[model samples]
Target: MANIIAVVWDFDKTLVDGYMQDPIFEEYNVESKEFWKEVNSLPDKYMKEQGVLVNPDTVYLNQFIRYAKNGTFKGLTNKKLFEFGKKLKFYKGIPDIFEKTKKLIEEDSKYKEYDIKVEHYIVSTGMTQVIKGSSVMPYVEHVWGCELIEGEDKDGAPCISEIGYTIDNTSKTRALFEINKGVHSGDSREGVNANTKIPEEFRRVHFINMVYVADGPSDIPAFSVLNKNGGATFAIYPKGDLRALSQVEQMRVEGRINMYAEADYSEGTMAYMWICNKITEFADRIRKEERDKIAKYAGSQGPKHLVD
Candidate 1:
């Protein structure tokens, strides 16, 4: 069997310094802090006043749609989203980490016969259009996130019609399963929640070969899913950010993650070394299992008969 390893990441604070919406806000002349403040508060306010529950995960997308309808962002099209992506900045070594980790596994002598493959994925609550347009998009195999529905052009400007897909904190686990099942973001949604079952051995990426990396509490569900399934979970924080460091420490103490490190992805950093070592460990185990299986099969073939 070909050995496959998956590295799944949470986008917002894990890869970038701040929210991905910063550029979108900038383009629309909206204040980043105020936009997020309203996005976080509107749902709660609506629930209290209207006695109706509005999903917090989707409210921001809806707000964008509302803004488009109100002519606030006349040219907020998919193209614009991608353009905004180009302006979004990422952390230390980001996209480089993907290639470096892959090289580390492939070049190792112990994994010579093993067809070791490393695949990267992003599961975020951010906008899919923006993420697809980002610099790290090329490095990731798939990106699962909230999506916007586009409508007819208004004065030659693309308009957002509605919220198509909304990914929240807890729902992020679904993306991990999708990755495990080899379902790409562009693939049909049927596979993600299908009744037809796939045997464990046939699954594309085994739990033991998974690595889930995220920044904080919002990713607890993903961390729990990976850790409970024998996969690795890593909690990362910005360097010198005491609050983030304290939160990561709390997560580790609570047993929500297997390890915690600074968000630095540069070569020789703790995050890089830890991931490289894990790949090596996973590869070694796979090689040993193959050998053991061969030995066991050979032993089952009771004494070979010698014919003269």
Candidate 2:
């Protein structure tokens, strides 16, 4: 069996400088801080005013959809969101990390016998359209986020109809399981929530072959799931951001992460080296298991009696 390594990531602060919405908001001449301020405030406002408890993640997606529907931004459409994603800036070595890591494993003679497959996935509360349109999208295998529903208008222009999905803090763990089960969004609608049993040997990806990287406390649930399952969890903080660093440090102290590093992912940086070494370690461990299994099977067979 090929050794598959799943590298799951959190989009926002983990991959980019700020929220992915920053560029989108800027393009529309909207103030990102003020917009997010309202998005953050709506849940409490709704619960107190209407007694309707709303998911905070849903509130943000709804607000964006509302903005798009009202024509607040010129030519606002799913296509536009993807275009904005193309313009979205990334942190130092982001999209490169995907290809570089894959090449490192493939080219190394040590891991040649073991078919090491590196898969990238994004589990975020960010906008799915933007992420799908972003430059890094090509590097990712799948994306789970708040998705926008698009429909055609009388003018044949695409319009935002509603939110198709919402991936919040707590819901992030579901994506991890989906990866473990090798189920994707479009594959089976009921697969994620279905209780169908799958045997251990048939499982696509093992927990020990997974890695999760996120920015802060919002990812705690995912971190816990990965850490508990023998997978690796990495907490990253923005460079020189003392507050972000302090928060990340707290998560480490609480045992929510296996390691913490600066956001710098450039070649030769500590974070990059750390991930490369971890991949190597995981690959080596799997290779050893294969060898041991063969050895045990060979030993189990008794010496053949000589046939006279």
Candidate 3:
């Protein structure tokens, strides 16, 4: 059986104080509010003018390209996106929590015996280049996000020209399965589609071994996927931001998220405590499963009096 526990995360408000791409807007002097206003309107705008119903989640990538081509976001390139990532203000405990969670499975003798390990992944609708450049990237095992294709602009400067791939809210489920099946690790060549034939015992990481953390309603699709499949979900709302809190609270009431916490992920914060507890629980459960399996086949479970 695979001894892996995956903690998948959503970007944006979940990790940083605000959007990861906010630096892009600030750097280019583009009004972030106005750009988002346009992004929010594009789907309906296209449907009305051309009868094409676009994906609201990732249509912003096209707008990013449009701005680059028009010189509004002049010289916006993958390199620039990476630079912007460094400016992001990540919430408290971020990358530290990543390493801490992984270490949890190693501290206990029982946990260590089973070889259970935690792997961190980011599945976001934000820019991949930006996420890769963030302070937290060093702790992350893999990232899934909207990627940009770079090409030469008129001045022969490399610029972001096209949307290479998009991991919208709905598609985040696929990334989860990719983790579940170990696709990103290159252990499962059959891909996520081969899941039905792959038994739970053999799959890289079972759904029960996953914990998904995100921000709001846009994560409903991902939340539902994990909830329905026996995984856990946690929501993070900005501290003192009632609107953000309300959004997550409503999701909890709707059964989308298993729990909600303030964005601070510091060592003693709710987010940190809850996540660590979940990891401990998952490790213990895996230990039990492994022990039970061995006992079943060996027909020897040691002495009941000696069992703790």
Highest lDDT: which candidate? Answer: 3
What is candidate 2's lDDT per residue for 253-288, written digit by digit as tens? 989988889998999997898888888788888888
Query: Model 1, stretches more than 4 Å misplaced?
Result: 152-156, 185-195, 299-308
Clashes of 2: 0
Better of 1 and 2 by TM-score: 2
Per-model TM-score, in order, reads 0.91, 0.92, 0.93
Candidate 1 lDDT score relative to the true structure: 0.82
Q: Per-prediction count of colliding residue pairs?
A: 0, 0, 0
lDDT for model 3: 0.88
Give the per-residue lDDT digits (tens) of candidate 3, residues 67-120: 887778889999889888889989989789998887778777778887888889
List candidate 2 stretches off by more than 4 Å. 151-157, 185-194, 300-303, 306-308
Error of 3 at 66 (Å): 1.0
Residue pairs with colliding backbones in model 1 are none
Q: Would you list the clashing residue pairs of candidate 3?
A: none
Highest TM-score model number: 3
